[model samples]
Target: MRSGQTGDEAAVDVSGGSRRGREMPLEVQHIRDALRREFTSRISMADYEGRAGTDFDNAFLSRALAARAARILTDCSSDEAAAGVIDGRDDFGIDAVAFSASGSELWLIQAKWSDRGQAGFNTAAAHKLIHGLKKLDNRDFDQFNVRLQSLADRVRGVLGLPTCKVFLIVAVVGEGRLSEETEAILKEAAIDFGGWGRTVEHRVLNQAAFHRAVREDLAPEPITIVATMSEGWHSRETPYQAFDGLVCVEELANWYADHGERLYDRNVRRSLGLTGVNQTLVESLTDDPQGFWYRHNGITVQCNTIEQEFFAQRGPSKPVRLTLHNASVVNGAQTVTSAYRAYERTPDALGEAFVTVRIISVNGTPEGFAKEITKATNTQNHMERRDFIAIDETQSLIREDFRLTLDKEYVFKRGEIDPAPASGCSVREAATALACAYPDPILAVRVNGSTEALWEEGPGGAYTRLFGKQPNACQIWRTVLLMRAVRDALHDVRSTLSGRSASIAESGALLIAHIVFQLVGTDGIEEIDSEWESGLNEVPALVEGVLAQLIPLMDHFFGEGSYVTSTFANEQRCQQLVTGVLQALAEGTNVRDLTTFQSDIPKPRRRPSTVSLIIDHNLIPAGTRLEYQPSPTEEQAIGIWLRNGQGRSFATWVDDRRRPLLWEADGQRYSPSGLVTQIWRKADWREAWSAVQGPKQWYVPGEGSLVEIAERLWQRIITEEWSRERETTKDADS
Candidate 1:
């Protein structure tokens, strides 16, 4: 459809009529229908170009082959918009056109509908394609119909840009493997296209390859797996055949080059990026090509039926030879892709590289079976850190339950699109927070480092160890907020701590989450207190305040020396740091004046409330004082006061550090409390015996030694409480 004439001239359709022998494949026909349904020509090109908002014919210029070509563009390319169908008598050699969203890349496609039979591409098909590409190359769409004219105008700006990229694709429904001569011709044509101030990439896709691309997009139709079999090939009672043989690396690479990531469609975790595992595979394939077949696991393919072409044309070591076609690798994606990448990087590395293969052909099973195999095979890959938490039922429940209950989308799977404003947290984030917030400090530290172990349900399962009770969606959401707060705080503190790298090592999250857990008492409900919400909402300030104290404490503790382990998840170090902070808080010995640990020695300041005074004095029995009330958090140490016979009081608190002589005065300077036994020994005989009897006793003034004095004070208070209750009963009776 090329001529020197302008837009007024009619086009010469180079594409002959469709080969009229056979009907289109059912799959291909379905695709054509889908394309026409999804996007049809809304109006005549002349009317559309004229900008007349007229009624559309809808199917005015629908072309099945052109529709398929447009569909390929929509499916495979990024930033692509459907060009729809534009076939006409004067459409030149081009069948379809699509423009990149940014108008920087232009795709021109030529499609041949060979409905009659499977025909290999020859020089004639290649020449027609080359002619169409030349029309684009010469900017010679003069003979083009109104549709191409309209498309050309839409991309007129980018087309002239020196860096513009152009792609010319030739798609066919038959076995049109390009002759070597055709490939060379296209390559030379690509060079010529590049000379015209633009870069060009050429592609040719046959029916089988096209189907692979489409199926990979979602759940694809099962493909036919052609297998070469020896006399040993056998069929069991099942509706499938089994065969074993050598599969060549070259063959694998060819498959990858043809179908690409589609081969790995069943993998739960697709192309792990440039991860160390992927890199290791890549390295092995590149450095040890011949041995790669031995080192790597061969591919697992899914197919509808298995057919064999066996021969006695033995290749040296192998006694017989066979060829397989129409197969899709259901597993061993990393091995195949890495091998492909390796081959691309170093072609010479491969010398007769071949792998032993096992082919299982499914006859009656549905496509679901193949997908299940994919998922099962992929799940067996060496577990990554995320895979552990990714499926934790707690996390899954949170996401699923949240979505159902709150009417919001929650994404726990990787590659899942994040909702706006991040309506959900990653399972990893929730698990990490739960681990840190767990009641025990020992497990919290481990949770930070070993995410993979968290989901284990066996003995000492990390999931059970950290979180035995099921968590609610609301709690998970709150945990997400806490993590965000902690993350923000790390970012802020990083700037203040100069010459120190600003990054908070992932191991540090446990300590930070622990800090938050300590600050905000666990309410057990999913929602946090307003104060915590405020602090977290303030970004990292609350976290920054805690870090401000911790960084210094860490510096002082590790001064001129270092920890044996660099990771913050080092249990001993984490325990020491967290315990130290809690102790500092109990003694009122920190900065920033937080409501709880703001100062160096929190004082009730005012006289004890009248109710407390009654409990402390008149209500107590003659020689005993009141019992102490323990804090709800078994982990946090509550302040307690004890008085001896002299009426002089001593203060103490308990926490992970377990201070014996916790703090005496303002807590500015402190000393170790030694041991629980030593504190008990200070009390009188009766008081010491009492102390030995119950560890919860913290205050009971006037019992000789400090411990007894504390115990006596608590006893008096307990007595007052009992008297108050009796008085209230008397009033009720009156």
Candidate 2:
């Protein structure tokens, strides 16, 4: 239900005036009527009048629209929706605020109710929204109205969640379109707020969508399903009834096609469209339909009642017909959706597929019984795609081979702890290494995008190609060693780099590993030799050389402004970059001549302090765990002291920039640099360095150091400012 388009229209005049000659459009009139009927009693008339002065009608309409948006998007009751409305003076362009039931998603709505149905979201509105978003992100609640202030704690809580998402809902009672210029303005806001991950997105609800929401609200329909279950039997409990049996895949597909998302209205979330796991399900159905019953977890349906059709003198083994009333698929939504997709793609293949089904009837049960069933079904830990691979014969053989041949632990199970670095390697590490070592670069790219692809089975899948024939123990161990070496080298190089270069170093680690594997010549890689192990010594230099060549080649081919993360993940781009890098190496391109690639060049000295930059950009989110990565000298000096205490080397990052690191060692907060000094003093190390660079010594595990992250942010800001200046100059010239 999300789209983007362009329209150019002047902003609506909302000043107090009589509509003597204006005729409201029917769509707007219908929406106005619906809102008046639903929210007249719920809204505060006095507050609206006080805020709007003489423009009460427009204010009321705006509030009503906000309420409707809240109800539609958050699935809240009318009372809650009305309470969410904060549309008035000092509202900061955000009309309403609502959070999902789970409190993991926040929706901030900006509504424009145009009687003439010509509302337009222009650059001015987009800027105002961005300003409000920035204020909220900074936790400046006092600038907002009383209603917004009242929910400050909740808002702050949602914002602090790492996985939380903020959706800016622009609800305009006109055509659902935005000017390209306005769209770019909003996109800039998204980029500013998103940082390394997409935390913000915007959605527009126009005239047609507004009407649809109103109609759907007035008369909501309950979905009913008719399914035949083989060997079905019912357990007649005191308050509820339960039925367990097998259902055909075709029936599930039909149910989904008929009811669509309505079948999962009561579920926590709708089907996650075509995720890797779901894609595998479709593959299973189309490729091996006969084995679907054995491979799949099937579906669960909860209903108000179930009516069974009587069969005269039929045996217990006969199929039973049942009509479910007000049915909702509480679990296995992905399975149902994937089955439908498979059926759509290859209908003939699904005839042999049967799925296990469990039906629960809430008739005469407790009020929250259905919800309890849903919560229980979804809360339990289910098997992931990787879990299936644990039982693979090849993996089992690899495990045995590691234990006997290499004398190392090769853990493959989901809950088993991964072996420490250099001690051994897990299946995940092995797969990534093997993918990087493979002749084809696509495997490396696919694994980089998602490791789920590594476990994908069947023809032309990574799993089939990598482990089709049980790989030798020596090959797996050796490749894993080389990959680990590449990662270590990249980690060191990333510490001194910033911006896109740092990102390329981190995200492109696998591609770099693949290129290094090629350069090292994998002739003796299959055999454990002194020469192969000695070649590991050459990896750091190889990594530097590869990066010097790779960075410029990537820039020359895929413009300097190209997103490093996307380019590294792209198969074609990775292939081309690899080819270009190999060509450059073959031609002996002197990277030292390139000033940007020279290792001896000193970085700019006049940069903002890491703490100030991190605070300004919110680079490291609150409550992020940071680990103390002691330098070799620090390790030698205070390693024993850190190990003496259980949590001495760990700290939690708070929002306070000046004193962000809350040290676990002493339950005290200190600045990053201060913390490092404190650790040195506490360890009583006589050889402690006088000047400590704390940001470089602390890390976010998989991510880089705080200084590296701050540098990236600084570089990003400079790049954006430079781009804006260039655009401005170009426009002036035109």
Candidate 3:
């Protein structure tokens, strides 16, 4: 057994190797070097695999490295000498432990290793480590900070002890690629954990550090990538395909743009007869001609910009009349006539000057084509610039509405940050309202004496508690949500009255009210009266904003729906609703105020289309009435015609029944027998809602009984329809 080895370490190692022996010093140094190499190698490979995989494995590598270090410490020191043992509980900061001479100092080492790229060590990784140490939810800044400060206090509580010393050793196994802000945080942590004015050393062992360890034979395994071929391999030709998990420059270029300029030029040149015209010079001119260049088949030829430029620069040199009568290319070369004029030669003097040249065209030159493709693709990154788009008026209002809704309903949740700023116009108003709204804390007293109440525990005690259902958390949460909605609507109304645009103001207020209704029960309005009064000054402004902008825009967006239906009663009902809403707005009261007056009863009732038919008539035959029944879909038309004249069947009744219908004396019954005879007479009403109630006959004009009943029934059906639709939508979402 090793001299410094613990009992467990000794049991693990069969061969005895004592640290107190002469070779102990050399052996310890060798092992440290080996560890350094392993760390460096992990970093390099991890980086190349890319961020996602690299990030995942980096965490895994950190744990593995810590385990390795613990094993090494066990080999170097006895159980008594090892100051800190790894606790399998929720210990996040301390990974491995080391001891000093006094046995007082506790060295806590945390390792961070990544085989991914350097850029992989981002803010998320930093936040993750910190969150773990603080026992807080990740990505939540407020929670993380609160927990972190609490942990710091706990650590500070124990610092006064003489035997206590916490040394945080952050072992980074690669280039430290943490953002500047994150790096500063780690540095600050080190300073605090090690104690002020204490010696705290930091080391960065990179590639060189690993190489030294490997050369000295201190590692357990050698770093190498050994390539081995399969048992039986045969190939004809493997077509071009991308390398797995890798995107080469050529592949990216081809993906973006299929055309390759270099290859195109080569093909064009070979088509024109210029085979033996100095291959290098021809290739150079084809790529980037100095001024102008020409292509010639056996008899036909065409000159481009390069040739034009050259002739222009050199004055009027000879008009080189080169012609190709015929041309063909075999194998690698082409045969055809080609001609060129000297810089000083005149066109007439150089008549008939022509020569035949052979040119070879290469098809499969991947290396050259790939290089060109890379150069072209790389240009895109530099050429492109980002531009910020401004929000349009409609979109801007939408964004504002969305923001209002989110703020009104988004809860910080239990055991998390609260959504309040200490100072502001809204804060003061909200604070006062909240204080009165919840005068006493809502408590969940249990039968047991335990004060701690877990969300999982319900109101029921241990006996039937096993089977008793728990109430929804959303129910308890809705009260507070309603308060938020009321406050937000008030704020928007106030903003609008203070000169904000009409649409903007109304949308903002409406959004707050909508969110509140969605989050909480919308049945009671009296309870929310105090909240409405507080936000009253802003209501009219929001209404005006809507009337001025939103209504006009809606009319334009949905052109056909702007026209009102011809029915007088329908128009009158709509006018009443609109007038009621606008009256509150005119008085500087928003939707919140109206809710108080109206009891917040949601409009638009839901109902089934089919209703059972009930027939009862004094003088009319029941069979005739049953035969004269109208379809459910024709209810609206029947209702409209009934409003105009008593006992007269609507046009739909004539079309559907193919005959006229007669009404009984009570006016509720329809009889088919009297249609052909015209003997059916209109019946007097029983006057159920008359001023004089001794079986008085009804008068149609200026009567409240019949009109009121019709209006009430219409409202009831509409409300039923709306509620049904709302419930259906809610179910689907859940």
| lDDT per residue as tens, model 1, 522-627 | 5654653434454456545546556556656665665412321232535566678887777775676756332222223222123343223433444333334333
TM-score of each: 0.31, 0.57, 0.18
Number of clashing pairs, model 1? 34
Ranking by TM-score: 2, 1, 3
Clashes of 2: 1
Best model number under TM-score: 2
lDDT of 1 at 94: 65
Stretches of candidate 3 above 4 Å error? 1-61, 67-89, 115-166, 190-734
Model 2 / residue 283 / CA error / Å: 3.8
Error of 1 at 480 (Å): 1.4
**Residue 692 lDDT (model 3):** 27
lDDT against the true structure, per candidate, is 0.51, 0.77, 0.29
List, residue by residue over 367-432, the lDDT tens digit for candidate 2: 788888899889877788899987788888898888888888898899999988767989999999
By lDDT: ranked, best first: 2, 1, 3
What is the C-alpha lDDT profile of model 3 across 1-734, one tens digit per residue?
Answer: 11222332112112123522333234333434454444432221221123343233334345444434433322222222122323222334444455433332334455444332121233443443443432311111112212123233233222222123344444444454446886776565444333111122333333233334345334333111111111121112123211111111111122112211111222223222212232222322333332212322212111111111222233222222111111122211221111121211122322222222221112243556534533443243211000111122322332343244333322212232344542111212222222223212111111011111111223532212311332122222233344444655556443333211222222223232322232232334234232423343443444333344333333343232221111101223223323443454456454343221112223222222111111111222223322223224333434354445644442112112223232442343222333311211222222222232110112123322222223334434434554686799899999
Name the better of 1 and 2 by lDDT: 2
Candidate 3 vs. true structure, TM-score: 0.18
